[model samples]
Target chain A: MTYYNIDFSLLDKTIKNFRIKPQKILLQFPDGLLGSPLQSVVNFLIERDIEPVLSADPSYGACDLPLNQAKMMGIDHIFHFGHSTFAFPPPSEFKGKISYFPVKVNIEFSWNKILEEIIILGWKTVGLLTTIQHVDKYKFENETINNSNITFVQHKEGQILGCNQDRATKIASSVDGFLVIAGGDFHASPIVVATNRPTLRYDPFNETFKLFDEQFRNKYLSKRYALIEKAKKATNWGVILSAKSGQFPKDKGSRILNMLKRKGLTAIPFIMHNVNLPHLSNFETIDAWIITLCPRLATDDYIRIKKPILTSRELAVVLGDLSWDQFITPKTGEHLLTIEEFE
Target chain B: MTYYNIDFSLLDKTIKNFRIKPQKILLQFPDGLLGSPLQSVVNFLIERDIEPVLSADPSYGACDLPLNQAKMMGIDHIFHFGHSTFAFPPPSEFKGKISYFPVKVNIEFSWNKILEEIIILGWKTVGLLTTIQHVDKYKFENETINNSNITFVQHKEGQILGCNQDRATKIASSVDGFLVIAGGDFHASPIVVATNRPTLRYDPFNETFKLFDEQFRNKYLSKRYALIEKAKKATNWGVILSAKSGQFPKDKGSRILNMLKRKGLTAIPFIMHNVNLPHLSNFETIDAWIITLCPRLATDDYIRIKKPILTSRELAVVLGDLSWDQFITPKTGEHLLTIEEFE
Candidate 1:
């Protein structure tokens, strides 16, 4: 029943602890956990006479909670698995009904291989960063490496969100480099860019290590720079915004819209739940597009999109407000409205 | 500038007649009109110093308006082209700012070919049905056919919605068959099933005719029947509901949810803006799915969907409250809650 080493004991205990028995409960999971033994979870609830519903939508992170949709169906309790709670507060309408279950993947850590890579790179000190799923393994690896000369700077949770890399930023100054204990470079890229430090991603599932060094960062930034140059010529820009729980950029969309208009450029704001290429392609008038939701869409999904698309941060660079270096390695307090000051 | 023969002089007049000029306007179009000279529309607006934003989302009908999203961006006025006003009223928050411009497509009607087909079918009287785009052409075609004994039953406005076939049902008793002047069988299928009449679709765009007779209906019904049989084995059903302007099923979703529970079946309500197979595939616990939004997703897009999916009407048949015949050829007042009567 415990496929992918996801412990549902905590989930079962939490449900039992609820003051009132929920007639219906919504079960949400990230794409990775979708193929897990979900029927087991459903069967567990059904045994207790609780009706369980699965949220089939693509859940990106802890930020993408289907609470609003759950509320509409009168289902109060939602078990969002695979990620921890996000930094942002849920909208007032959807408060306190969500339970975040960071389902842990029990994988054997390739500590020797990681240590060998660190020694080969000649790193004296390293910062240990990981996602919620591998946090326990991260702590164990840190303790095991205590005998070595290489110092491991550990943050409170050792977690890094695709959007928020504050944890890595906090410990960046103290560590020589970062060793991200996660599946892919997706979690490590932000750390490398934001901290401007060498980061290595260790995939315990495959026991492989990929380094995100200066060369990798330069290559990534060059692609982004080319996109900014392409976006610079755009006079009529479509600002894509999402209304999702985590992805929604409150007043940032309007501020961007107002800034563009003041610069004598035409800007139209498009709002949707999930922004895809096919939907954005419908706007033929839009010379370029700026995505306000999920920065990855601007960075990672740029190639697939036909039109020149830039991130809100990249827009600042195009508007001549932020330098290319400043845009890539964003400092504290720098945001989408930094362009407004240039106005 | 007038690709697809869509006249925009009326759209121009409508904009000029506005009491105040809208600084930013949202242009929404159905899929057919998305590729048609949109830049001309954009240039025309730009010439008037108006900022035009094209809605890139797939607009199924006038009902799929992005007004809420428009209002969120402080865009008050929206020019929804290519379809007439839907039967349902806009949400209370978005009551007034919409201007529905049913852009007419001027196409040379193959009257001789249509007459020959009708004569071959041996139809003495036929009900005329056309969408708003071809309503003007429909009027001319009706007048020309008046010389023959094959009387054409004309309604107030020869328009048909995929969801609502009340117009076709209105003249069903008077006419022997229906001549739908449109492109595909998508618009014609509903009329054929609902009215139990032979419906012929004349694609003015291609000048081709396709007749949806008893054989066609039987073929369509058999597929649905097979799905119903497959769905009958499913204990956990995921009921898909959309929150799009026109497609939102409102209270019908909840009604179906309650009906499913009353019959001792586990039903999960999935509320999404755009429901697709990939997103729905994530729910491994869902044995089958019921689409409460667009009925076409169940009827037409069934093959694309992997699991057994049913419409709200079909759900009644699976529960044994409504017969398969009653489910397909639904009479007045037969609805999603018709199953509740048996409960």
Candidate 2:
């Protein structure tokens, strides 16, 4: 029942600094972090006589803001929990009302052990990148690395979202490797595969750091290549037009459909609010799928839907608009070319 | 996989008659019917090159239109399946866009058995009311009752929604008994209790008919009285402001809060898109709940939430604005007194 730490002082500071006196506020927390702390937050707001509306819908990451629901309820402000602010801009309508309160996760591990491992891996300079949670704590300036041989450089962006790893990729040439101070390989593996940069993932929950290097990248790339190959031969494609707040690019499906049509492939756009294995099974005629959802979904090849699901970028690579090399290792500050580019 | 009958001819007739040449259509089916038939319906529309967006949310009945989702996608029309037309008009904005195609469930029960049962029960004139499924098939004129001892009367409204049984209540005095030609007492018991008339429930699923008379009515009334009595003693109330497409009366929650404040009750409104057992458990201060979602939810006492749940009408009864008698038998062609009326 240990709840993740919410920086109340930071939240209060932000509200005061912004001069926000909210009447009706919408609160959105990632599905995993919604529990006692969420209830306490609601009760706290209620005690202050401020109306708080809790969004019960699933929120995957910071990229998926519940702006539509907030607008419908005519909420004055939104407090998004459990993720960093998106590197990319949100829909223009959500300008002043939204606030990000990424909950900080406490990681209790020996930095000495991490430093020793870094030296053993023969890394002299490392780019420091972490999920939003540990960003405030892991300032490279405070880290007492006694060895003059080691240099730790903080990314210009401060933190990295799984979908937006510009900072890590940008300094890949300057640093020997990137160290991710987040839980799990979910954020780490993608950076390694996308940028071909060696990355180390630190799991706070288990107090372990795993190296995602050549082996992981090769596996991910080979599988992605196989999926692209399968999709290249696909006569019929089902373009996933998710209705979820984060994943849905409103006109992306139509653009993909037109592109597929031009290539002499029959493509049908399937609008789904929540995609599940059985639900996708309904479209029996579809040979392959191009998911226009979370860019991260493309890397999640473990989801056994029995169909080759590719990201829009992968689709472009298979269709020859871009090579696999160009699709991966996107130039620093260059945003991932979503199907929106075609439009 | 067999899908219950979808009257395509009737659908085509309605479309042609209405001159609705929809380029993009939204299709919504009740949660139970969202399988093969839903797929077939989508494929059929796709064959005509009419873009179909299948709503993957829980649709309780015709009242739960996916109008919001439809409007978001800019769909030209919505075809709601598995429920009859809503007894009440939708919000004015959704006037032309939404249509209900209540799928007919073919019941193979013999009408002769029903006629004999009515005669044996000592009823001379009986009003025939049914669900959307059996409405078209059960023709009152075609029922050959040679006995001349019984007369079956069909109300002008013809069908009754489980939530709104105005038609049955309207002609209650005109008939000795009411015969509901549907599967369950979900549509029958309320009618019987409301009208104080003996009603027979014909279960098409099991091909059995059961009489719901004084005993059943008294039992339902007692439980309702007990709930009202419990709510009367409760100091704190949580008015469930549901965000579902159908059940969310947008302005209803604030109005209820005002009403409760006027009555000097400590009431807090909780807005939820979906209410679950655990979510309801969070509001520890609230002693009782007034749910505005699906009218049927108020009657589902079996839900393990361990709190007295009341419908708006029952709330009115407890608060002395309306008597139980008036609450039970609503006037003919009149809608139920939803919580919206208090606004």
Candidate 3:
């Protein structure tokens, strides 16, 4: 019942202070955390006399908000769990309706292990990146490491989002390598390919520093290069676009379509709620698909796609951008970067 | 490549007279028609120097339009195939942007077979209902059947849409039975149960006249009654609402929520783009789900849905309007009918 370690006091105080009597409220949780524990959360809300409706839609990241659903059902409030705030501004009307409750995982491992790994790897200064879960802990824990030889450079936000890693990319130049202070390969693996810097994960739960170095990068680079080569020969490209508020890269699809046209390739853009393979199979004419949606989907979801499915950055190679080779890793979070800006 | 039997000249003439210079257009076809033949249609548009973007999303019925996508990509026109005009009015902005091109399936069967079947069944008067494809032909052909005792009642619109059979329902009282001159069971099967009248189909391609009598209606009634029985015992119900233009039953979700509340049952509304099992599984507290979507899905898609899922009509039985027994058929095109109006 106490699994999420959510601040019940904070939630209660916020609801009391907002003064909006919610007849119905929606609770959204990421796919990983939508389990038995959520029932307890539902009971917690019910005990307070608030009717809670769980959003069954896929919550990939903070960017994929249930704002449209909230507005549709006239839900007074939405508690989005397991993620932090997105960089972009929410709709004006959604100001007080959304409340983010990020799950913070306390690092149970020794902090000295990261420093020992960095010294052994011969990296002088390493960029420290973690997910929202351990961002605060990593910031506080960084001060305890007094090794002058192995400096840890921290970004302004001090964390990385799965779909967006602009914070780490911004401070990539100031560090020799990147050390992700979190569990799992979800956030760490993508940063390695995106920044094209030496990246290693300091898993607190496992208490191990796993390297996602040259070997891992080369495997992904080869796969991306293969897709690029295939796309270069493709005459017709299906540009996939999403209409979901957060995932709608507003003008990105049009820009990609125009870019393809300039290369003398025939391309058409398709707008979808969620891109499913069964629906995409209807496009027999499209030899390849360029996903102008979440950058992670191109790698994470489409590894087995029969036809060559490339992300926006991967399409840059076909667009005659030779320097994009540095960021050849799939599912790399560079949604904002254009073909010309890939370094 | 000359498939689809589309009137190319008619299409050409319509485009010329519309006076809109469309550089890019969208082409949407039913899932069944999205095959090799569509390539010829694409070539037909491309030959006319009109760029065509094929919509790959699943087209359930005429109601599910890609308006959001059409607007997002700035598509000049949308050529929807295999369907005719919707019963409900389109949005004001879509007045000139959309066009319907229904696919006419030529009747290879003799017209006498229908009359022979009606005479054999001893029906004196029958209501005639054809799909958009055969509307014009049926209107002309109805004049040929001259029987003093057997009368053919024609509706004002002369056809019925798959998602709506209100036109036929309006004139059901004057006829002994309804004859749907459509190819498939999509339209005819639902009308049989909705009107609680004898319904028969004279399929054009198959050259057959089949009746969906009490036996067929009874089977559907049993299934729907079971769902209603299950929903009656459900303490927590998840009422799903959709925001997709056509799918969004504007205020129907809230109305249903309020109705459920009035019955002293605890229910919450969940607005979604489309209901999927993975998303619906997150709602552990909800024992049953009420789908306020295309009425067809509660019967067609949710057969395998683990938790008992009930349509609005089915939910009505649980809500105390016991007359839902009259409209026990699944996929009935009765969006406007409340439980009380069934009788």
Candidate 4:
């Protein structure tokens, strides 16, 4: 990555010319010790400044730097941002002061939300994880794990969470399956299976925990379930699907109409307009309406569909749960499936 | 929040009197457009730059900004570093040229690694998600999601992923849950749940996906469930846990030892370094041993014990589909119990 930096190259060269003498130079460090942090030190010395030079580095947690190389480059003193990652040894010549930045962790993820969701997931056992950058914070999370049915297996030593495969494999053998959670590219699931253990990748990115199941979600839910529930309620189903000015469903209100007619329930599929269904439009007659949700007027208009309305995906979800061959037959066209005469 | 700016307040008096009557000027953006992109423009006019000005705004995605103020502020030309959220109407009088700089998306997470672990999760249904910062890459992932039983659902309107509660809730109801692969605080879990969906967050700090169940990981991924199938076979009957470090179990490590012990095996527990095996010198007599599993030393050191060693958490998975009460006697230690213990 070509970092757009405040170019200090010109200033460094000016000092390197040795034309000006320096006393106590105020050397600034824009970036930290990830790469080179000896610029200002070298600049100060070239200008005849004394050895007590000051600079800083960011050590968010633990930091690994080229200290010997920095010393060789004529560095003197240092101030650090973030927490201390290394123990600075005292030089043979105890010279200048070294400062430390307190390690303060921002509330990036709320545990309260996690705990609440855990209750919702009915998760009896939880997989706990974090980044290696925050090792101390990882330990702090242990207590929180104690309050929940959380299994706190930590992935340590590597820059990312799953670098150590053997470690996670051993962990997988212990839990029901592993809950793999982490920030950035450091989730712990890839490594958890190294031990031939089953794992659930708990993605903290969207605050949801789902077990790894290779089978499609078709079995867990269905569209007919909504229709079934609505039918049993003995109510009229009002399906308001989207057919905008330029875009229209290829089926053009055909598939859903056939299915409802076969099921012996009255259904309508069309665009939402003011003149269509006015006045005493009792929603009791409508059982379940499948709405082809569109981006153009979705949030603005679709929210008004009082009766249970299904989006295209939601309709698909219901179709998936039932045996596809039984309800809908595959057909060749812009549309893939046709409602089988509901038989 | 403490911006290390040049503290231009010191130069305000001098800058106020120095006015540049320019036909066009370039204004660079800092902190992206999450902040006001007009800061530089306002400052320039305040500094007395009294003619038509050209400014560059590196704003991106569907994020909209006030351009009328700019036009009123005497903007005759514009150069943007990144994509614009809205179509720019051509300047009425100046007929200035408007340009764009496409901000390329950077993949911090390795897709190969993400794919490998998902296969292990063995789930038939999965939800895909990303942060607003990475919405651009969602199209490329469409093919990847298609390869498996995955459903990619993003907040279609206004691609900003995190920090928007209404959108998150909308998304939560739309899909089962989401697999969020993200970088920085932008993809944190609580932020993900703002959508009211169950989310699995992948850390993007590293170039590859590292499972979070190892003791060596940097992030605290205690909510993840990962199993490790190692090269070595375990022969231990049971394991023990400890609080000598004053740290509670992170869910994954909470209960492997007891499960093995319940299946007619011996499970032992000890304080830190407090174990004194009777057959310390015996090679084959010792069965498998289990512990909290912070394997600081390598397998080379533990070869003398010569038995199948395991963790308390690992044994639980082997005894899957069993009663929790049969293994662990729920104690009243501050140890929390999450879905990990039950699920």
Candidate 5:
């Protein structure tokens, strides 16, 4: 058996030069990292006669809590993993060292589940959301909510990427909830909730934690229609809108255009420099029209229409390409839909 | 009084089109950045179309922290001021649309201050420390310490441009404190505190926060020595050495050779792979040696003699010719030190 058991003698000597006592060492980590790499690091240090300590973050998962932990533990050195957004203190004759490594990870979490859960919890109208990290993943989540009573909307919040909930709900006409799909709490769930729109969030990294599922979604929708009747007296019909990057088909503007054509209605995508609806002709007066969001204007412009409009991002489902629950259900809420009485 | 204003009616009109309701944007800031370009930005935004929300970090005093104020009034956006080391979570939409503005203030904050503070607490002897950020600043801080009672020793860990305190502390022996003069919390404080050293912090931006003055620093030091004393035990010195690249003297190798000449010591700085301390006769049983640190070594052989040594970055201080610190220290601790510290 010609075993490839080469030699670690040189490695041993080399490591000895870098050797440290079994002093406690701490490491900080960011979210979206796997557990395997951490284990490998631990093993690597132990092989060099060093002790390794680890700690995890609450939301971002495992931030450099381990690094702080190592310092507290009197560790001679620490190796941290995560986002590279802070400075690591240098060593002093009296203190140890802290190092950083921004390790990447796989496995993106879904947010459609979170929307389903909201619907189950008795929420009807919803504004779709995502962040820079998960913005690219919106397509996968959008596919799930293709055709359903649930209306999902996406908005392009350039500098206002997160926490444009007030704008979302106000423009959404009659928003019942917000299904946020993204990273940590920075994406702004409370802002939307503050506008009387309950919020359900699904972190792109952690999946086990969900909002709600389908069975619960339908039950809530049955009750939501009546609520909508009351809201319609004051507001109007609710719609699903998505306004992400064009490169990301998550907005599905072209698809929505196709859907409106099939519905015997003309859906026009207008990128206007000036706001003049006079040229719209019959577009100004229709059964129900959507501004096929192409970023010609902000959400404020859409509200002026004062009519029911489906979000380009969510029109795919209304077009009936996707199965009835394309949306993910993470938390339990009133934002679900029931197809029992759908036409 | 006459003020020159540069504005156009058309530009203002364009901005109004992008306007939503008033927004109170909050930001997290560090100390040194208190007087940085952030204030300029705040003024700029205020003059523009947006309302500004400000907050300072209490930990590093980077920025203002008006959480309660922002929450009570319901802020719309938050622009955080910090280093580029993180994808720092913006205030949640639940909170607001939080953004980031990297503050350019450099001062090795973490380990440097921790080491210095511990020494000032109760330390009789401590080896001064340095990292890439302010390795050159070691000289400035050392000059401030003067060779008086505090022994500002220099040491090196690796080729890393940033500071690594854990790696630094591993080599520090019998040190009561290791004063690091860097910026931010992660720079030196983490490493020093991990070794149980009572650390002291000196933020270049301290004045921006209206926090401490020089008098406070002086008072803090006397007390700091006591703190360091309670933190650890002390040890007698062993090797007192120096390197050719000690403290990056403008004269480089000449300085170390000169110092050795003055001491009548046959200490030959090995710029090459020769670390063999010629067991020559008659050298004072050294107290603690200096391991000169070279900026970008020609070869990795200088660190061959890992015995307690001072780095060239540190030696640049002992000899009092270090000029690069002006850039490094200011850049180390600022929330976002965008410009290179060592211009």
Candidate 6:
């Protein structure tokens, strides 16, 4: 029985195709997909004589896999829904254990408004981008538009993550503008800032298209610059390093800590699984914070935190290691450090 | 250098006395002690040529150690402050790595008011109990009172956890009533319920003494009984198994899942590092929840959760495997499963 338009038959087929039998499997879902028929999935597994356990933690993306917890509980196989495989190598121990199932949303999309808006902009060639949920829709619409071109980054066609905008950047030189079919400006704004080109975002949920222009990019950079200025006055800093599967980079954290110490600033490294506002506020003596985990914690959650929180790249700007222009400018190819820098 | 009355010299001496010089150590503090001098501690470690890392996750007690995270970061030493060592044994992998610092509060207490109240109550013999922060005060007051007696449970003198009340229960036959010198009723209420005796809690922060009587016990149990009745009608259950250092019990969780299945109820085991309202609300299909982690989650956080949540013992009552009287009665000595069952 399918609920919330999630196709369970695909999951069943995928499990049946596996070579070894999975007696116990861990199920992970993003917050948006939690309303799906969970009991039905539990019953289905029970009928097959397989035990299913749900991960009751906030799963941000494919990078936030609870592999350690799964390993501790002896759950070798994991089925992560709502996102595809992240563009990063898994830890050595959890290489083949994780299976990503991009829960594709089979919903109707009205492309008339976005297409007209794109045509009105007088763009000859346009790059198409979307998230995993709307990749099938993106593919179907890719064939109908003659000016549209879609590129594959890693696994899916025309899919881009919040941190990785390679699909839009790879075809930036060829396309005049870009059209992103996704939920909101969260995915589209990065493309606009990275490519420095006109980008139109079609929110399938709200059925509206909005353009991210040069004005939006300037505002985003100005906010980041203000935070960097605030961080310069901080004498003590808390460097937040994530404990998620792919987010934890101990070496990078150590380098940042060493840099801050050289500048005569008291820096403390914090290892956390969830970096929420409450957890950050616990360090009362920390004048500022430098989050080495998700870049969105600096960009999106800045207002929620009282102290000035900056990303690693932004911290580089504060320490005179990098210029503001170089920090915002888009780079070519899938760089190894860009995954952590952007995220 | 001293902030919030935390003695740093003790920590310094303890580190210097260790035979193995630690190059890197993880520092963990509970939320109540986060406001203490953190940068001073960081500076102290830096002066010794050692790197210090702070754990930003919510630390509930000594049981909430981040051993796995520390191991992953290659930090072999951990100094857990604000609470003493937990009674449970550490995981085999992290046997000798953890060190506990009680962070004793050096605040003055006016025990005259509490002593007068106890005298008016006409209790000839009294058993003393307090937490790590107030254990020194408990010992000092024990020497002055003619009828006061203190008992040791595992580590500290006159220490009682929210889940474990053995300090009071061990000397229950010798004392007419119990006097707990702590901040709040969190550590005192369990003693009142477990022993079913007259208990007085002295809030050192406010310097007030309040007695927990039969009326208070009845009110607490009535609320729990209401939730258990509400949970009996639930067809779908979310069994939460914690991933904290000492809270994770996979065997007990499996037994609960099996019992639920035998009773024809759909039960899904949830493995969580932090069990909060937002995380529990993500499972929309679950009609009720059974948390096998901390007992306080069911008692303290029930009002915040919309659905009924029962502890393992309460779940036992719902399943008719345990009577309500047996669930509340105090057991003798240190039982193997009592730690898990109470927590």
Instruction: Please report the candidate that would top TM-score against the real structure.
Output: 6
Model 5 misplacement above 4 A: A1-106, A140-142, A157-172, A208-343, B1-343
Candidate 3 lDDT (Cα, whole model)? 0.71
Give per-residue CA lDDT, model 3, range A1-343, as digits (tens). 1244566776777678767677667888876566655666677787888888767778777878776666555678888887776767444335446778887654454766767787888998888888776666654444547644677788785677776677777777678899887778888887766677889888777687789886887788787777778878899788887767667664677788888888888777777777786567666777899887666667776655678887777777777865553444334335323222332
**Model 2 Cα interface RMS deviation (Å):** 4.1
Please provide, for model 3 over B140-199, each residue's C-alpha lDDT reduced to its tens digit, 9 standing for 90 to 100. 445447643578887685587665677677777777888888777887887766676789
Q: Rank by TM-score, descending?
A: 6, 1, 3, 2, 5, 4
Query: Against the true structure, what is model 4's DockQ?
Result: 0.01
TM-score of chain A of each: 0.90, 0.87, 0.85, 0.32, 0.30, 0.87
TM-score of chain B of each: 0.89, 0.85, 0.84, 0.36, 0.30, 0.87
User: Of the pair 3 and 6, which is ahead by TM-score?
Assistant: 6
Tell me the tens digit of each residue's lDDT in model 5 across A1-343.
Answer: 1111112343244345545554445444333332344445545665665544433222122111232223223456545454332332322222554444434334445445664566577866676665433344456345556655676565553112331233343434456666666555544433342233455666656553334333334444333233323322321111122211111121343455455556654333322111233322222223343343322221223344434333332233344543334322212221112111111
Off by over 4 Å in 4: A1-343, B1-22, B25-73, B77-80, B83-102, B106-109, B116-124, B131-133, B140-144, B155-158, B161-167, B203-205, B208-343
Q: Each candidate's TM vs. the true structure?
A: 0.85, 0.75, 0.77, 0.22, 0.24, 0.88
Tens-place lDDT per residue, model 1, B77-159, is: 88888888766754545543788877777576877788889999999989989878778765544655766667787777778
Clashing pairs in 2: none
Residue B221 alpha-carbon offset, candidate 4, angstroms: 20
Residue-by-residue lDDT tens digits, candidate 4, A237-267: 3445321211223253456555554665544
Task: Please list the residue runs of candidate 6 whose C-alpha ends up more than 4 Å from where it truly belongs after superposition.
Answer: A1-13, A116-126, A140-156, A172-177, A209-211, A262-264, A330-343, B1-19, B119-126, B140-156, B171-177, B209-211, B325-343
Query: Which pairs, if any, clash in model 6?
Result: A294-A343, A295-A343, B295-B343
Better of 5 and 6 by lDDT: 6
RMSD of 4: 32.7
Please provide, for model 6 over A274-330, each residue's C-alpha lDDT reduced to its tens digit, 9 standing for 90 to 100.
777656887788889987876777777889889999877778778888777777774
Over B181-244, each residue of candidate 2 has an lDDT whose tens digit, in order, gives: 7876778877776677899988877779989998987888788888888888887777776655
Clashes by residue pair, model 1: B63-B246
Top candidate (DockQ): 6
- Kindly indicate the candidate among 1 and 6 with the higher DockQ: 6
What overall lDDT, based on C-alpha atoms, would model 5 receive against the true structure? 0.37
